[model samples]
Target: MASEGGFFSAVWETIKTIFWALIIAGVFRTVFYQPFWIPSGSMKDTLLIGDFLFVNKMAYGYSYASCPSIRLQRFGIDVDAQDICFFLDGDNTRLFGDEPERGDVVVFRHPSTGQDYIKRLVGLPGETVQMIDGVLHINGEPVQLEDGGQFVETYERQGPEGRPPRCENGAVGPGADCIKSRQIETLPGGSSHSILNIGDYRGADDTGVFNVPEGHYFMMGDNRDNSLDSRFPASAGGVGYVPFENLIGRADRIMFSSAGRSMLFFWTWRSDRYFKAIE
Candidate 1:
């Protein structure tokens, strides 16, 4: 009888400890840093398909309107940790911790579906952005490109005669047998990044000469022709324009990356991408 009672007591204590730990973690993640798993390749080359990341939740101030509310613990430990929640510590209740600069990578809620998306900021407010003949221009100035890689070399497509032909990165698609070209882009405010041109031309190639309205953001994907972003109109159920209120925190770093299968229990993990800072 004594032995049985001791075993039961130990189990009970273990369960209680686990319950408290979970509750504490939940509260912190809600108000501070939260983990997010990359669900798609929309931000590919910057954020990979199977990357696990930590988003700075407090980087943007929280509103009861954004996340669902929950009960707080009574007599909870007041762990006054600044690193845990940075924005709340400062007097500036400005929705964002720091004013988003040009070329900074950000994660925000999709205006159309309320789903989260991670993309680089290309055009800033009050700036004129347009794509011309496979080049990105900020205020009519062309952006520069950097050495991305040789992935474009292996790319192939169909020839005019319908045979497999060597392709370029900007060749437009299977129908266009030219190497698709891209350029390193520098935003007007002096930030540099890259843009891809798939050779598939659209009217948008010469679009967006309008001045960006105040508090509105214009964003596009690094994949250029593949992304359905602010370039598309709202009637298409795609991201046309992003409002300030819909902005979430910026993506700071990659906590983990996996290419094959994402079984957490697997002992072998891809260590190369762990703790990598997002460019």
Candidate 2:
């Protein structure tokens, strides 16, 4: 009888320890950092589709969740219910408020879709943003641009006959068909990054000047011609001016990356991008 009682006590202690451990982990995840996987090539070259990174949620003050479109989250968390009870009842809670800079790469909840998207911060709260002939212009002044020459990338998942995953930027020589010109464009604060220019006229290439509304920002993708960014209207399938409150966090560095061939295959891992800092 004594031995049985001791066994039960040990089991109870283990249960309690696990309970507290889960509670602490949950709080930490909700407050400090959140893990994210890049599923698209929107911020290509800087961030790839297979890249995994941690978002710094505390970079900006948290805002009350107002998006009604987040019904089912990936972790099975009921974000809608949580927002309704914890954030939406007129108690707009925030802390350590800070705004994103011109070149900061950010991951945010889409204002309309409630879907998360990653893009580079291009326009601030109250600046006029426009793109003229594929050149980024801010406040009616054209931002500086310099040719950084060519960038060629090979697809690990390309088909045998160079079929499905053809390069959209442009083909290289007759042998290699994936090459694009990488241009260096300076932002307002002298922040620069590599942007791809396929030298093609796109719908979002030339856009009407947008007077960024108060408390909102304009974002664009690094892949100039292929990215569907703020230059296009939201109605036409582009992310319009995003509200500051919807900003989730800043993407600082890549934690890991894969080529989508297989996660279990160690050879398929992108070793170079692992733990690389985001510019």
Best model per TM-score: 2
The clash tally of candidate 2 reads: 0
Model 2 clash pairs are none
C-alpha RMSD values across all candidates: 8.9, 4.2
TM-score between model 1 and native = 0.68
Which parts of model 2 have CA positions greater than 4 angstroms off? 1-11, 65-78, 81-93, 156-176, 199-201, 261-265
Q: After superposition, how far is residue 123 of candidate 2 from its true place, in Å?
A: 0.5
lDDT, residue 238, candidate 1: 57
Q: Candidate 2, after superposition: displacement of residue 13 in Å?
A: 3.7
Model 1 per-residue lDDT tens digits across residues 120-183: 7777778887777656777888776565543242223211222332334334555333443445
| Collision count for each candidate, in order | 17, 0
Once superposed on the true structure, which residue ranges of model 1 sit more than 4 Å away at CA? Answer: 1-19, 64-97, 146-149, 152-183, 201-203, 261-271
lDDT of candidates 1 onward, in order: 0.62, 0.74
